[model samples]
Target: MEMVQMLRENATLLKLGYQFELPGPRMAATGILTRNQDQQRQKRMQERKAEEVVEQKSATSSNQEVPTRKIAEMVKHQEVCNKAQIRKPKTKKLKNGANEKESEDILKDLRNNLKPSVKSRHEASNLPPPQRSGRDDLMAAIRGSSIFSLKRVNLT
Candidate 1:
């Protein structure tokens, strides 16, 4: 009976040892997985570096130096000089015009005609009184529309 029990125990120990044995192919599979993970990490780093380069280029392009005040003043002076040169012919044409007195009279008449009309004190005193409300004004406008609404036909 003791020998049989010892034999059974030895069989159980052997089975446990077999179950714990590492498979040869599994080690190679794990090595492939680690290499793939390393490749993925390297790819991500390269993409990040490329993005940084693009960002740096754009930042540099946007940061141009502004022109100084002296340069702006020089440009303005050149423009004024150019405009003065262009207007010299117009000044000569004005000097060559005929009948200056007649032109002056016409200009005076035009100025007088374009002046705004002013109400005299007596005329303002004779004006009609203001209406009491918006409704009264609207009614007045409606009553005054008959002349505008009249229709006329050509006889010829």
Candidate 2:
């Protein structure tokens, strides 16, 4: 047929490094060319493996073992401590009227304890300011742009 001849011509052109545009739909009503039965068997085997993995996970979750060593260690530590002496020490109750006076005394002690450093403000400020150049600006611009953008493209 003419269609078959055209297909053969296209194949020859393609082999010779020439591009050819085929016209219309060239589909045939024939069955698939790849008739390998091994692929189906492999797919079924993979499904069975996945099912086994799921079964194993479910089995592990249902039959989880408690750590007996950790439980025993906790029990042993509890037995060593005396419950009566382990109770938290009671804080001395502060009288409502004396609380304000006590707080003022604490603040006074804190303010008296703080000592001013020997360094003068002018001495700290005497350090030179950092220098900026055009190179820094160029580097920042390069970092902001994508590396892929640096690639050269030919329009022709």
Candidate 3:
């Protein structure tokens, strides 16, 4: 009775039709509350802090900046030099137009020959005859016997 009274005292009354939430282990557990605006603001502040850190690092090493800049320029210049030095051999244009046409025609003929011919639906449905078993032979013999014959003969 005391525990029930304590629970009733700690319970929160909801606005919707006398619904109450009793304070227990489950009720005490807090869930994550998501606020998009707050999260976005925090993300922006983190990015700004990162940018400031990069700026401060660059500002601190003035002597190192010159060598780094020179190295980047040298890398770009070397890439350009390498691209200019290595020339791809230009493809020679075929002079014989007749030979090109002949080769294309030969390829078309070979491709057509390599392709399999499709069978018609009627031919595809043609199945092999079913193999007879001992049970089938027994059934046929019983049907042919005179004792179990289903035929009726009329006599005048």
Best model number under TM-score: 1
Candidate 1 residue pairs in backbone clash: none
Residues 1-156, model 3: lDDT tens digits: 343344344424211122236555323222111233345668899999999999989888875657677898999999998887787566545556557777778889999888765665557668777899999999998788887575678998
Off-target runs (Cα >4 Å) in candidate 2 are: 1-35, 65-156
**Roughly what TM-score does model 1 have, to 2 decimal places?**
0.29
Most accurate candidate by lDDT = 1
What's the residue-level lDDT of 111 in candidate 2?
A: 84
State the RMSD for candidate 3: 13.5
Arranged by TM-score with the best first, the candidates are: 1, 3, 2
Residues 1-156 of candidate 1: C-alpha lDDT, one tens digit per residue: 333344344422221111213555444444444555666778899999999999999888776555578789999999999999988875323445757787788899999888765666568879898757989888877788897685777899
**Per-residue lDDT value at 69 in model 1:** 82
Q: What does each candidate score in C-alpha RMSD?
A: 24.7, 17.9, 13.5
Give the lDDT of residue 85 in candidate 1: 93
Q: What TM-score does each of the candidates earn?
A: 0.29, 0.22, 0.25
Minimum summed lDDT over a 10-residue window in model 3 is located at 25-34
The true-versus-predicted C-alpha distance at residue 25 of model 1, in Å, is 1.5
